[model samples]
Target: MKSKGNLWRVSTTVSQVAQPLPEDKSVDLVVIGGGFTGNSAALEAARRGASVAVLEARTVGHGGSGRNVGLVNAGLWIPPQEVIGIMGNAAGHKLMAALAEGPSRVWRIIEDAGIDCEATRNGTLHLAHSAAGVRNLQERHRQGAAMGWPVECLDAKETARRTGSLAFYGSLFDPRAGTIQPLSYARGLAAAAHEAGARLHDQTKVTRIRQLGDKWIIEANGFTVRARALLLATNAYFDGIEMGFRPEFVAVSYFQFATAPMPARLRESILPGGEGCWDTAVVMSSFRIDEAGRMIVGAVGDLDGPGRPIHAAWARRALSRVYPQLADLPFEHDWCGRIAMTADHIPKIVALGPNAYASFGYSGRGISPGTVFGTQAAIALLEADESVLPVAPVRTHRERLVRAKEVYYESGAVLTHALRPALF
Candidate 1:
């Protein structure tokens, strides 16, 4: 069967209006790709009194931003201690401290902008799928406590009570985490940016970017736009722009399936604490409920291919295994998106030219990091200060075997979905 054109059809229904690009124009800043990073950067830059124009190949949030699982998690996928170990004390501490308030920043923006994205702040649960998983959670709990974070390690009984599933031995609960309707949130950002005086253009594909003397010239949709500065916020959807540098990362797919709204009684019993959750399986699985009582079960796979049935079946079985009461629920919506993963699982902001920068490689954690980094990037670019950035900008580097790693992740997803029962 042919795949659907838009994986996030449900979200597009209420999204903001898409503005057309100007025929020939110039702006202080031209942002490429209208995902979370682009929209957030545009909003911040405009708020800072800079003339900004955003060019999106499709609608806002058409990529991973729209297809995300909507978990507004604080920090990256790796724990704080692991981050410190990788980057040493000073740099790591900067990143950890900056991102520790990630979800708070995101929620504050949503509330201040009056975005109706089903925003929820009940918190998130990190379930342990195995004994080793439980041990890892314990270590994370300790590290989080040391940092004065509001994180708790729940025992098996408490975990079951919170998650409505006895399949896990233990879990980690973080009050800083929450969930949102990702597509709506993305569109809301675009709307807020527009309201803040940023010009947003949908279906405006940037074909080329080059530096002409002191200014950068952007060619898109049969027009040219000259800007004093440029921001390549494309992330995984980069289309070969000449930014003088590229992010060292590979794209991996993550998919989700949402069931029809469940009965109120059943919904109350399942995930009663209203926390978004993901387990510690090798090929991780996530579960959460929407305001409409729809159970969304997600895993790593391309849901728009021949493996759809396999992934769909695995989701059904996994849901049944975790919450037997809703075993018969039928999924109503299924979708997938690509996540940019770096070698060290860290996000990067590279300086491509005098006033040009490219930020990417979120490694499947976009919500809070995207907002925090984009906001900071706008401030740094406008004020010519790198001190406000979440992570130190990469001076210069080359990605080792990125193509091979991309293929490895895609092939691994296929094999994992093909052998679902055994693996799950």
Candidate 2:
């Protein structure tokens, strides 16, 4: 069968309404963008008894939040030490502590909200694609251990047994991480937020945002809103509204394909423990088995762009190289999402004048950081306490040569996908 649309959208059991924005209204806070961050912030704000409104340009989870690989991983892509080196010991440790608990925080929300997003806490495996990759994981394991993180490094034999494939050199298993139906998680958050008194409006595109005296003025879809605090959580899907400050980051695309449910016997051997996995290749690829036994694999490239054929072929080849038994299976669903990659691979919280902030640039790590950042940002804004933010808010952030970097990334993915002749 030809590829369907996004697998999460098709498989998600959770749902939310897309109500229109009410005009000429005012509230304590106005959140732009209705993905994980906005919905999360709105949820926290409303629960704290602050009047809040969320305006989503499109449907909830329409952006990266809906389109991710769903590996609710902890911490950023960079090493723990590197984060410390960049942000200093105190700040780094604070952010790391916050993110390291990200999975639990998410699970708590899921449990309290009773969100049924195929929630699994079985953990995740970071597969080593090569001997060098093994060394890299060893270093990561060491760093994690130094910080008292519960990370374990598995040998090649254990890795093979866990992955049901003899492709990896080794693997790093992080018990703190897991997987979920990402879109469902976002929708469930939105639903819970609405129930908690947050006014959420989808399909409401903001045309302009400006500071009017002490209040923030937002004009969207012929509607106006005045709020004491504002959060632009648009991330990679920013609509470029006439806001004075725009977040800067290179947009990189990641695509995923899912196969029809495998037979019980076959599925039982592959990822039987239900750990989501990703490899260490530069052009990284991720794989996992959903609750229904469907095998989903993802890689860093656009499946909807000119390199579609190249990426598709690479995906098939990569899958065969790892799990040759599943080579004959055809993908039944495919979709792509853009990532807001900062040069430093760190998320940013840009201060947008007084009582206003814009957050973006999670690189590829969204689920946890988005939740932590969103939740904390809400509390900080509502209480006028910036100290609660995980990352220090900056007055301005800029990325140079964003377009060129985007082209460079896409070209690299195309070239890499087009020509990796050896076994991975």
Best by TM-score: 2
Give one digit per residue, the lDDT tens place, for model 2 in 104-173: 9999999999988998999999989999999999999999999999999999999989889998899999
- List the candidates' TM-scores in order: 0.95, 0.98
Model 1: per-residue lDDT, tens digit, 208-243? 889999899998888999998888898988867554
**Clash count in backbone of candidate 1:** 0
Cα misplacement distance, residue 400 of candidate 2 (Å): 1.0
Query: What TM value does model 2 have?
Result: 0.98
